[model samples]
Every structure is written in C-alpha cells, then in structure tokens.
Target: MEVRMLPEPHTVESYRRSVLGLVTALPAETVGLAEGLGRTTAEAVTAAFAVPRFDNAAMDGYAVRAADLEGASPESPAVLVRLEPSRAGSPQPRPLRTGEARPVMTGAPLPPGADLVVPVERTTSGRFDDGATVALWRDAKPHIRNRGEDIAEGAPIVRRGVVLGPRDLGLLAATGHTVVRVHRAPRVALVVTGDELFSDAGPRAGIPDSNSVYLRAAVTALGGDVVSVQLVRDDEDALRRVLDSAARKADLIVSTGGVGPGTHDLAGRLAAASPDGTLARVAMRPGRPQAHGRWRGTPWLALPGTPAAAFVSFEAFVRPVLARLAGALTGGEPASETVSVGWPGRAGAVRFVPLAVEADADAIAVHPLGSPDHASHSLSAMFRAPLIAMVGAETANVETGQLVPVFEPA
Candidate 1:
C-alpha cells in the first residue's frame, strides 16, 4: 500500500465539526428507571401527574376558617371546638365547621371549607386530639402546599437528549414514570498499537502499556461501552486484521500510538491509505498527528503514541463524538477560569495546559502543572491536574490573571 503525505493541520473547531458530522444518534431502548442513570433520553418526558397530587398541609397545625380567628389574641383569645384529628395518608376529613377546628399533621390533605392552617405552637392546646377546645392567639396564614405547585400534570419533566442523573431519576419516579426511553450507549473498540510496550508486572525492556488502561477507563467514564481492547504490534498486516475484527464488534474504533510520522507508525500508514480516511496534523500541543475517518464501515480515530497527546486528543475529539452517538446534548462552550500563574504557549498551535484547579467562594483559579512543550512525557503532571486550560493558537503566552477556557479531563 502507498503511504499518503500528511495534509495541512486542521484547526480544533474545524476538526471537531468534521468528526461530529459523521456521527448519527443510536437507536432508543426502553430501560427501567432503576437502570436509567447516565443514559441519555431519546424523547422528552412529561409529568404523568401533578406534583403534590392533592392540596396538603405544609405544617403540623389546625385546619380552620380564617374568619374564626378574626379578632383572636393572647389576652382575648378565640375559643373554637376541635373536631377530629387529620393525619397524613388517612382519608380526607369532613368539611371543617364554621366554629370548629381540626388538628392536622404535616403533609395531610387539607379539609374542605378550611382556608387557613394555624400552627399548633400558636395555639393554647398544641395537641392532635378530637373534641378539644383550642385557643388561638393570633391569625395565621394558610400553610397549605397546593397541587401542581412544583410541576403541573403533562408538563415537561426532562427534555430530549438529557443525561439522566440521580435527581432526574427521583423526579421521574415522583412524576409516575417507572420506565424511560433512552438512547443506547455507544459500543467502542480500543486498539493500542506499539512494539515497545509490555503488560507484565516484572521489569521488562519495554515500557508498561498504560494506554490500554487509560483508554478503557476513559471510554467507560464517557458512557461508551468498551467491547474489546486489542494490543497490536507495529505490523501493517496485523493492524489491518485487528481493525477488521474491531469494525464488526464496535460502533467506533479508537487506537492509541503509531500515528506519528515515524517509519514504524503502521496505524497512521494504514489509515492514510484508506480511500475514505483523512490523516492530518491538528494544531495543538502534545497531540499534533491525528487521523480519523471510516474504516471498514466503522468510525476510526488514530491518535499519537505519546501518553499526554493521546489523552488530549481523546478529550478534544473522541469524547464529543461518543456523546453525540449516545444522543447527549452538551454545552457549546467550556467553562472558563482565571489563571493563577503565567504559562508559555505554542506559536501557531493551540495549547492544552494541564492545570490544578482551585475554586472558592471568592474566585476560581488555575495553576499550570508543567510546561506544555514537555507534556508528552509528563504523565505524572497530567494525573495531578484534573482540568485542561485551552489557550488559543494566536496567543504565544498566557499572562497571569487572564481568563482561559477550561475543560474536565476525560
């Protein structure tokens, strides 16, 4: 196979759009609410019933007509005969009489003809008992929680393409939803290619294969199911076989290593030879050599061999595509943070500087862990920093106290 020359490097924004354009949302599947966490909804979910199904008491008090305590006070109290007690989960009590009061507990359905609830503390006899005379010192406001106050019946509970969280599940449960329809998680296949890598525990001549572990964990954390993880040597024929097998088993194929310009970069060579693939450099620090396109009818992303570059490329490119396939709608822009210290940047390449974030009530700031140029071998620094600061390609250096876009590490 003939090796194609690498094309001009694409900007981060243009490359992201190119990859995302090729993705289509996965099919929807019905799942129980118990298994719905982190799943993206395929359709909008509306409330089956109104929240607070019925008008209920907001406090433990006496259900009474506001007019009864019109002139009530401590010295000249309004004495009213108490009827039956009203507890939560019990049948609705009879309509409150004009000169009578019914003792009520919190969350109990309000009695008919009662317009106000006088807290028990404001009454002389602060007790829930039948046939008792209670003296109210002052008039109290109606402490009733109205039906549909929180969410009205048939109102939208969650919009389409929303990732279900713990609170979302609780709301769905409370709104009478036992099952939800959500997009299926995308199936991913990982290919870690290299000849100088070893997976054994003992000291070996080759470096330990950390890419397999990192890529697997990253794919899982992004809601993609890792179907297979294959480590292939630096051989074109062997790489082709693994790619063919991976295409059949996964929706997307992610390969770490062997995408650089080195002669032993078999992944990059094969990817460039494909009729539908594009192998180009990305204008970014640490991760410049990148290849992506369809291979054997499966989407393929070939990343650099360097650990830091692989990580940065995955977060910048693969993550959004996976989210799209899972039907998740994410924010367009990343949140920004102020820099606590100055850092140098690449002249014509975008800089993804690993940072240790410090957030407080006063301000949120970021401290650079290490130099961006040396990020390829700074795996320890990457581990210490959970956030990546994005500096524009036009900027040569970021000054202290400057705001920069920041994103979470995958």
Candidate 2:
C-alpha cells in the first residue's frame, strides 16, 4: 500500500487574497429603475433636477403671506379672502397680493409671493373647500419643502460602488433618473462532483445534493448569475468536459465535492491538471480542502463536499470574490454583526458555526446551532440559523458572554 500526504493548509486570509486577486468587476449595463434593485452602481448617479423640483407645501394648509397674519392667534384670528385651491400637478397660482390666501394641498407647489403655510387644522376651516374666506388662528409657519432640500441639482444622488436599495431607487426616481448604469451580475458556473450525491433520493439510498439549491439562491442574492450547474460522477472526462463548457459561458466557476485525496476525488486532480490550477488545504476546519486556478481564463474555486463546509466556504471566501466581481464595497470582508457567545467550542483553526441569534436584554446572544465536525453537522438545523459565528483561528476557546463576529448569509 502507498500513502500520500498533502502540503500545509494555506491561511484563510492567504486563500481569500488568492481568489479575490483573480476576479475583476464585470462590465456595466443600463437597467431601468424596476430592474436595478440590488445592483451596484458603476458610476455616480447625479440628480438631473433637485428633489421637490420647486418650493412646495409640506402639508395640507393655507398658503399665505406672513405679513398678513401678524398677531393672529386662537383668541383673535386673521380673516383673509381665499383664492382658488392649489392642488399638486396644477400650474402654480398667480402671485398673491395682500389679504389673499390659497388652499395648498400637501405637495402642491407654493403659490408665488406666499411666504408661509398655516395648517388647515389651525384655521377655522378643517378642510380645504371653495370657501370665500377662512379664519386662521395660528400665524403662518412656512411649512414648505424647498427645492433641492433633499438633493441638489447636478449633485451625486448615489455614489459609485453603492448597492441600490428601495430608498435609493425612490430617490433616483425623484431626481428624474429613468435608467442607471450598474455593474452587471457576474455569471457563475457551479460544478458538483461525486456519484453518491443525488438531488432526489431517500436517506437510505444516498445523500441529497442540497448545495445546488442553496448555492444558486446565495449567488443570486450576492448579485451573481448562475449560468450553469453541472453534476459530474467522479469521472475525469466528465469534469473536464463540464469545465470546458462552463468556461465558455461563465465569468467564474465553483465546484463542490471530490476535493480530497481519495482515489474517487477527481475534482482536485482535474483542476491540478489544468494549465494554471493548484490544490491546497486551506487553514480551516470542514473546508480545508480547496482547489483554485484559472480554467480558460475564468477563476475556479473548489470547496469541500459536505453541505456545512460548502455553505461556510461560500460565506467566508467565495462571497467576497462575488462582491468584488459585482462591484460591491466590501473591502474583502463579509457583512458581519457583533454578537456575544453563549457556548464554548474548539477554535485552534478559524471555525465557522451556524448560529441562531436572539435579543437577550440589552445584548444580542448567539447560540451555535449544530456540531462543527463535518460528519455530525446538521444541515437542516443550519437552514434555520440567521447568522454564522466565526471563531478566530488564534482563539483557543470561546468564553461565555464574549463578543464575537457573526455574519449574515448574503
């Protein structure tokens, strides 16, 4: 019998740098506001016109000249003749002379020469009607939203590298933007290896391949397009064919399973045979066996076959690369939240644990969901967790109530 040994595992940071170094932002494309949700801006979006576009009333009120309502109060009111009501989208009413008032609905353009607005509630009339005159108890307070108050004309509404959200879209639309230039989602090719992994099979038969389902959703959430998903049955030729075909259609390639030193583990072997591929053990439990290289100029990443390992590796390593390719401003770090540890665990190497976080009094408490060991780890329980707790590689043990880093799956 012959024995084979792999080299020392690369540090997590070193592996991440290697993977991110090979990725670049995808090309920019124009997308309408409806389609730009969660897309990263390729350039700063400048406002074509100021928010509000013109001075407008902020509430349903009476637009009046402040000079006309001097000394007006609940005890003694000011009587002013009302002109036509000024509704939104109607042309701005003609300039108001002294002793004149106009019913201004919320968002209605302030009539010219009207310096202030008194809420209809504060006036004798609770609602605006075609009234001949109205009595105002409180003096006008000028409840007007001025032009450019929220955003200035020609000013940047959204900066480059920003991910567009619902509020961002609303602001852009308010600033008169119909379409925006955004970095296109990077197309990803998923290659799953191993003959035993099946998508539909009883537990007694073989393990279910749930990686594809979660990986596809994760890729889409991270702003990457899954162009191809290939399952190879521990065959060198099949892996090669899929890689070759995937390279032609994808910007990046991700393979799950068959990365170990076993004879049936053909994924690592095929990748090592590539023109620019190398197999290395990363310094992390569960996901230490990793393969990286370029297949037809597209970056390829291989993760451990286990569901827990694949999920953790995607969050720690693959997700940052996707963010880079998608033009998100992650700075090589996954989105994280501070959490207090509730249990102790082994932490010689960087460890990732699916965690369920809860609010405990004034602090956030995190409970590790399942075992860290690859075989005993629970995939079903992990799905219920909202966060992944990352134990530092140098920290030997996690102390109770100690603050730790928790990451939300993108």
Candidate 3:
C-alpha cells in the first residue's frame, strides 16, 4: 500500500464552515407532542385555542363581583351569601348573583358575571364550608386568568428553528395540539473502520471498539439517530462497500479509523480517490489527520482511529454539522466560560484540553484532568471532564491564573 499524501492543513474555522456548508436539514415530519421534545420545529406552530382554553381562577379564593367587595375590610367586612363550590376540572359554577360569592379552587373556570376573587383567608369563611354568608375582610380584585392571556388563539406559540423542551411540549398540548411538525432527526451512519475492532465484552488480540459507544450517545444527545453502525476491516473493498451502502441510507456518513498514513489505512486512499474529496491535516492537536469527501451525493467524514482524537475531532467539527442537519441554529460559537487554568500549549496548532471545572462564589478554576496531549486515553477522565479549554494556535504557554475560554461537552 502506498502512503497517502495529506493536503495542507486548514484553519479549524474555515474547515468547519466548509464541511457544514454542504449539509442541510432533513425533511420535516409530524410527531406526537410527547415525542416532539428536543426536536426542532420545522415551521411556526400557532395556538388553535387560548393557552388556558377558558378563563379560570388563578388562586384558591371566592369568585365574586369586585363591586360586591367594595368598602369591605377586616374591621368592617361585607357579608355575602355563599353559592355552590367549584374545583379545577369540575363544571363551571353558576354566575355570581348580587350579594353572593362562590368558592373556587385554583385553576377552576371562572363563572360568568364574576370579576374578582376574594381569597379565602381574607374572608370570615377562613376555608370552604357550608357557610350561609361569609364576611369579606378586604376588597379583592378579579384574580381570574383570562383566556388568551398566556397564549392568544392563532398566535405563534413556537417559532421555526426552536428546539422543543418539556415546557414546550406542555404548551403545545395545552393549546389543543396533539401533534407537532418538527424537523426530522438526521440519520447518521457510523462507518467505523478497524480490522481488529471487536464488539464482544473483551477483545483477545485487538482493542474493543469503544468509539461507537460515545459517538452513538453523542449523536442521540444532539437529536440525531444512528441509522446503522458498521465495522469494517482496513481494506479498500470492504470500506467502499460500507460507504456505498451508508451513503444511500444515511444523511451523513462518519467513519472512524483508517485515515492515517499506515499501510492498512485504506480509508484515506478511498477518500482521496473521490471526485470532491479533500484529505487534509487539521491544525490541531490530537485530531490532526482527517478526510472529507462526497460519496454518491452523500457527504462523508473520516476521523483518526484513536478514541481521544476521534472524540475531540467530533466536538470540533462534527458537532456543528449535526446541529445544522438537526435544523438547530448553528451560528454563534460554542457556549464557553472564562476560567483560571495553566496547561501545556502548542505554538502552531490550537489545543483542546479537557479540564475538571470547579467554581467558587465568583471565580471558576479549571485543571487538566489528564495529559494535555490526550494520549493517556483515559475514558474515565474524559467523562469526568466538564470543560474543554480552546487555547489558540499562537498560544505558546498557558500561565497560572490566566483566564481561558472553556467549552462543556454535550
């Protein structure tokens, strides 16, 4: 096997922009409101009915006319007759008559002809009872929650590109929406390459294929689904076959391993052969060798075989692409915090060092979890790390107590 030549390294920003530019969101799909949580809205969802649906009481109190309680106070309370009680989800009570008050539980529909709610505590009827007449100590204004107050009918409750959450699901369901139209999660094919990789509990000769575990979790956490995960030998024929099938079935193809310059690195050879492929060395530590190409109109990305390198590369490149394909707004940079840290740095390449973050009352301190080179290959350390500090390429050395931007993993 001949050594594959790597194209000159591209700046991380430029490379990310290039790769992400080629990918787009998948087709939209309608799913039940329960299943729509964490999915991006394909279009604006308008409320069919008001959020509350009907006017209801905002508190547990007596639903009465504000005029009936006028001039009522603790020293001189207004005596009013009590009507049938109303509780949440129960039938609406009868309208309040002159000199009458109706006991209402929290969230009960406010009856017509009633505009105020005198809290039970403010009246001589300390709590609900068969009291003939209760004394209203203080004049209470209407505590009724009006219809369309939370959400107006036909108003947009959720906008496009917004990811649904727990509260979002409730709002949609409350607004009489049984189903929601959301951007379908992009189907990703994991074309992991390694002849010695095994899925068994333990590998006799080769290392266990562990990248798939984290990669799969990462994909699902980012709102994408892994359509298939295929492990192939370090041979051109086997890799090409998997890539071909994955390209046809998946929206994105991600391959790990077989991108190096070794004799068995056929992934690089195949990627280099593609018409639009660019096998470039990225200007970064740990994850430098990478390949990007198009196979049968499907975009393919290849990362180095090492677990640490693959994960770091995934965070640096694949994350934003997945976000874009999931219809998430991918404009701004990653959310980062400035923390005090001192670690090794590379002068010519950007460094991503995982840090165990600790926050004081007003200051955040970050410490390197393991070797800054990530060569230790400690999976536990990676899991424990909450932040990855991005030291710029020009940064030669990170001094103690210096503030550095760090990113938390998803």
Predictions in order: lDDT: 0.85, 0.81, 0.81
* lDDT (Cα, tens digit) per residue for candidate 3, span 72-105: 7888899988888899999867777889888899
- List, residue by residue over 1-410, the lDDT tens digit for candidate 2: 12232477788888888888888888899999999998999999899999879999998888998889889887788999988888899887899899988988889999889889899988865677676898885543579999889888999879999988999999899899999999998899999988888876555677778888889989988778999887778877878899999999999999999778898887776666565677878778658888777888888888888887888888878888888888987744545554455555565678777777788679666667666454126776567778776777887666666666777775
Worst 10 residues of 3 by lDDT: 331-340
Sort all candidates by lDDT, best to worst.
1, 2, 3
Candidate 1: the clashing residue pairs are none
- In model 2, the runs with Cα more than 4 Å from the true position are 1-6, 71-76, 122-131, 137-140, 201-204, 331-347, 359-364, 372-376
Highest lDDT: which candidate?
Answer: 1
TM-score for each of the candidates: 0.92, 0.90, 0.90
Whose lDDT is higher: candidate 1's or candidate 2's? 1
For model 3, what is the C-alpha lDDT against the true structure? 0.81
Which pairs, if any, clash in model 2? none
The per-candidate count of clashes, in order, stands at: 0, 0, 1
